[model samples]
Target: MRIFAFVGVFASVVSLIGCATGLTRAGSMIRESTDLSVRNRCEFIGTIDESERMGAGQGDNRRGALNRVRNRVAELGGDTFLIVSLDTDNSGAYVQAEVYGCGTVGSSASHAPATPAPSGREGSMTTGSGFYVSRSGHVLTNAHVVEQCREVRIPPTGTAEIVARDDASDLALLKNDIANQPIPAIFRGGRGVQPGAGVVVIGFPLQGIISSGPSVTTGIISSLAGPSNDRRLFQMTAPIHPGSSGGPVLDDAGNVVGVATAKLDPFVVARETGDIPQNISFAVSAGIARAFLDAEGVRYEILPSDPALPTENIATRARQFTLRIECRE
Candidate 1:
């Protein structure tokens, strides 16, 4: 199915761009609809708040931003949308829209669209985890986490820019706009990490469902390598959940040793091996992350292993640098 998207500008009226006047491939399916009757009949999906070229100070990237909102509407199984808000910020323009699912263009709606159950899910929003790598407010997370985002924010700090992304290594570096005295993670030199060593993972797992702060899971490095003998990863027994990607994995001394990445799917493993695996996850080695930061010219610190601290104490310190990553696409 093709997408038909057009969002009306609000009182501020930032963009002058309009919909295609004639039918094309993608243009024909999802067209501009100012008919309130059509909008009234459709069930409301949710609001899409997106920014274009945010924090870039170039002004007016509305066209690109609205296109992303349309794609997102289609992804949510919606067929039409109406711009509820469009305004300019200090750095860029943004649009907030309401997406709806009406039947075919000419036909009467057959069934009412099901609104997603309010089971604590961030509806039309995606959340992940990240940690500060430098005092300059540079953050490191999995590239996939921010690749699809139109606006990446670290809560009260506002918008962040994707300074660099490495799909090959599944790492991305983000530079936040405000330098609000952020706590940067101190990585332990790569030489000391070993199998069977105790590690702590600090992240926002399950986001809205769990406590607002970070969650701590403790485990040991199960192997020195990952699946298929990937040496850049550490196989660990710590739990990695949906919103836990890119979180910091710390050793007993409160030094970051790796970045939490993935966990095995129990059902998939069961289908392949006739058994279930539990607490089996992987994190990119901190050594690899450190190298990526260095290549990007980010000022991060790496110190030798220090005397071990209590697990709770390590978690308290690591939590300062660990943060929740909110992505709007």
Candidate 2:
């Protein structure tokens, strides 16, 4: 009888240790996949699901569900899993993810440097907001800001060379020659963003006439889809002005969740629907932005997820990379 009791206690201890180790490995592997090259190494495996238990709070349940998904991916010999979708029902939270085998790293594609801008200007100055994405001084902003401009200026960095632009997504990439650089914005991958997440926007509003420094606005993600249920865009409650275009819509952890693009025109909408929309702004989702950057062969960094920081700290960190984009058109 004593031998049997000892065997049972030992089995329980071993099981507990195994569970702890699995959780730790899952977290480490997830962080490792944040590297673009590392991510490229992985090939999609299969989709997996994890459901939360009943009687648990929403937040706790969601976390538990995610942990289980990660654990399962690891068990299937996958290094990482990209979140496809998440849903909740009366029973509990459910997570669906695509598994990948990230064993070998892949090489990143390269592109030619941006051409130098000519030393001539002949247009009115229009200012917008942008942020650095790479150590090579690649800046991201709205394509419309520089589409018709003869010269583009990024303060402290002087003139910038337009490298790439996607009119459909309203994203443009610029290169600068400044030696001193700011903190580049980090992006969250896949379906990292969800509705109701806290968000903040930093930009030069009112065409930068209101303040010499960038302004900050705080709100939460109103919806995962945009106007007319557009999947590429997301809606947020953050107030964005004309000059706020091309700015970074950051999460509480200082990760770039989206790019502040446009706000609903109250006049136009009211004329059509006989009603005004308040704080209905739109941002290009970070996942879509990441795809554009990859297609352009732009090197950028990603973070799996960072611990939540104070709003003030997040804004301060963002300002490092955020710059005022002046277009001479």
Candidate 3:
């Protein structure tokens, strides 16, 4: 029997360049809408995570996977999806594998269309996850999505194109050939989120053909200003998976407070040898994101404006790698 459920979502937004258009305004337009749900937009792409030895036949497994996808789709209000490719080798008792894929969704319908897959090209080569952020063709995604690529394809309409990406921050900026489209996402604001607040993590985890669409999980803010080596990051207790990188982390009020970046406990060198890491996750704070945009000269303003955030803190801007690597010895 197949069952369907809704996946919940967190909130966030990002961008580059000091432009008059395609910028995300922080924390104002995030009212929960009835239209944003899995029943309306989420779709599946291909298979990335299936097990033949799990005692379930292909049909049973496929239905099980789709049900998972359906649940996630309802959570993030995402319409676009992707399949991540993995490099694996059979090891008799089990298969060893590494994850590689992208998935994305928008809070709004103004997302640009994806480019068509070329005939005979390996489907795995395509970038998968991304979300809409601006009305003028700007989309936000991990810089790794378009990394080393001459171009990338957007969703729903097969719109292929080139983009200006910033690799240092693992963030990319896409200039959609599509015109005047609004990108919907949780808004950012001057009032930063506090620790222990409720949060939802949204993304596509483990590429599976039957298991496609947005996924959501709930937890609380573990820390408001967690350390990312020398950089500051927001930490959370929400369980996350491989496909969730570069997605949104939302507050209970449905406002975007951070961008999903990394799972804290997945870095174990021996993940299978009793080295299971607790599923802690981290995100780039909205303040840091705002500073990044400011350095790039992007023209976004925070909504419901914050009077407590230091003007210097809000005004400071810089460009740097967003990933923080900390090894506990």
Each model's lDDT: 0.69, 0.68, 0.42
Q: List the residue pairs that clash in candidate 2.
A: 123-329
Top TM-score model: 1
Clashes of each: 1, 1, 34
- What is candidate 2's TM-score against the reference? 0.62
Off by over 4 Å in 3: 1-118, 126-128, 160-163, 225-230, 265-275, 297-301, 305-329
The candidate scoring highest on lDDT is 1
For residues 29-148, write the lDDT of model 1, one tens digit per residue: 343234456567877788888878744442336556667787888787776777776666566667788887664321111122323212333333456789998898999987756756
Cα RMSD of predicted structure 3: 16.9
Question: Residue 85 error for model 3, in Å?
Answer: 26
TM-score of each: 0.64, 0.62, 0.50
In terms of lDDT, model 2 sits at 0.68
Query: In candidate 2, residue 216 scores what lDDT?
Result: 96
lDDT (10s digit) by residue, model 3, range 183-295: 45535565677778777656554433215555567788887754334244677888655445555666654445776655543322122234644646777666665555555
Q: Which residue pairs show backbone clashes in model 1? A: 4-30
Q: Can you tell me which runs of candidate 1 are displaced by over 4 Å?
A: 1-123
> Which scores greater on TM-score, model 1 or model 3?
1
